[model samples]
Target: MTAAITATKAFGATSTTDEVLEGVNLAGKRVLVTGVSAGLGVETARALAAHGAEVVGAARDLGKAKGATEKAFGKTNGLTLVELDLASFASVRAAADGLVADGRRFDLVICNAGVMATPSGKTADGFETQFGTNHLGHFTFVNRIASLMRPGARLVNLSSAGHQMSDVDLDDPNFERTPYDPWAAYGRSKTANILFAVEFDRRHRERGIRAAAVHPGGIQTELSHHLDDDARRRMTEVVEELARRPGARPFSYKSIPQGAATSVWAAVVGKADEVGGRYCEDCHVAETIDAEGFTFAGVRPYALDPEHAKALWAKSEAMVGERFP
Candidate 1:
């Protein structure tokens, strides 16, 4: 998995979302990007809409999202403001069904919303909050809308480098028997994102649909909202320590636009057509983690296994009591 796939490649980590989209125009294309109130989510939606794509800003609060969209686009034409609380399966179904009822067949679906390091708690569906919201919610949302994905549609799941922390423990996904480590929970969900994309592509590639998982690199964003002040301080300290370590890759913190680059690239860039299932970062297909930056780069073998991906997809379907065509 550490080997890089160079079949098609373009921009790199420093590319901004706008840059990756420089000559492309998504005019008349319809796209849906979740968690669009701020950070990479807002930038992603803005970038797409700026290029004439009719974008949907799916957020937890329609009011905040309206204001955010207005501020980003100056006017929200081609931007449909909608509510989607990923912590609730009911909410995910309602949002998808609402889109379906409205006759929206999305050209692109970006599962960009996620939570990180949440304290012990359960989502409205009584699943672990981080795992449920970040993985199961998107899992249900994507499957429920699979039939609506037109031929050649693209689906991007926002996974993370944090995925390296753990794989999905199907036998104990809720941590009822094992100790619940927030980081581990987050890792499992992120891994699920990758697994989801792998299986989705396997199932639908023949229909011209493409699915990809993206790690947007380290960008300071609202994904950390669940962390308390003390936890935030500790997280910062740990990263700073990693930064100071000899031979470590420089801690390159991307601006929101930069963070949004890869997701948009995966969604609209022509280069991604042949690159499904593999993980990407910094707007390009990542390379192997060399000794110097061995800590970052490329997908772990476990995360990229097609069998593992299919297994997780089947398990997720069973968990949500739904099926993807």
Candidate 2:
């Protein structure tokens, strides 16, 4: 489950969504992708839908989503939209409920909507903004729709390499006792994304369902717009310093197509058992790195630890006031 597959060695960081999914036919599949109003989400939906799958995209702004998807779809069809604001529990519940009531099963669920580093704030439900929108929101929404996933369904959570910066603090996920560092808060939330996948895969894989987290690589999307000039400069300095280390891969911005490629790779191309409960990037299961600092190619060991994932599941359940068996 940890090693990269030779079968997927043909694809890597530079691969586009179409490149990775070339010759792959997804006919009759049903996929749900969130955050479709922009960036990777639109491309992910576009590629899947174009390849003959029905994709229901969720977005906070339905108006914007309609415009974006229409443009992305171009000559392609099979893409639909649902209203969802991960920042609001009401929206999450309503969306989940509507999908459940419809009685249709999904072959894949990609939790891709998230806010990056931003000024400290709280959700409508009073949880930390980054943690709430990025993790708790998807936690509640996905669990509610769990029954709709077909037995062989795969759940792909769009995590980030930033998870290397820190581990989730169960006792203080909202940064109550700890000082709020934007990148650390973002890291905690992203790591939660991975842990959520780990636990979900463990709980559901017996039923022919599995989950994996994905790091989409560094893409120049609006995802990082929250970073001010100084913040961006500081991040650049850190990456530059890291690049100078022995055997480090220098970071470079990826095209949106390349960014969305890994999510597509995990949801459709990866073998269920090989990728289940693992963290993937560049179309392969990433090696678990034991070193300090983030790298372009691997996941941190803590991100995949069973005990860490289990604790996150419990804490997430408590935070959202819901539990899944």
Instruction: Give the alpha carbon lDDT tens digit for every residue of 37-87 in model 1.
Output: 878788999998988788887999888888887888788888887789999
- Model 2 per-residue lDDT at 86: 97
- Give stretches of model 2 more than 4 Å off: 1-9
Instruction: Report the backbone clash tally of model 2.
Output: 0
Each model's TM-score, in the order given?
0.92, 0.96
**Clash-forming residue pairs, model 2:** none
lDDT tens digits, residue span 1-325, model 2: 1212235447889999988877777888899999999999999999988777889999999998888988877843788789999999999999999999999999999999999887889999999999999999999999999999988899999999989888999999999998988889999999999999999999999989999999999888888888877668868887898789898776788999999999988988888888999999988899998987666568998989999999999989899888788
The candidate 2 region of ten consecutive residues with least summed lDDT is 1-10
Residue 309 shift from truth in candidate 2, angstroms: 0.9
C-alpha RMSD by candidate, in order = 4.1, 2.8
Residue pairs with backbone overlap in model 1? none
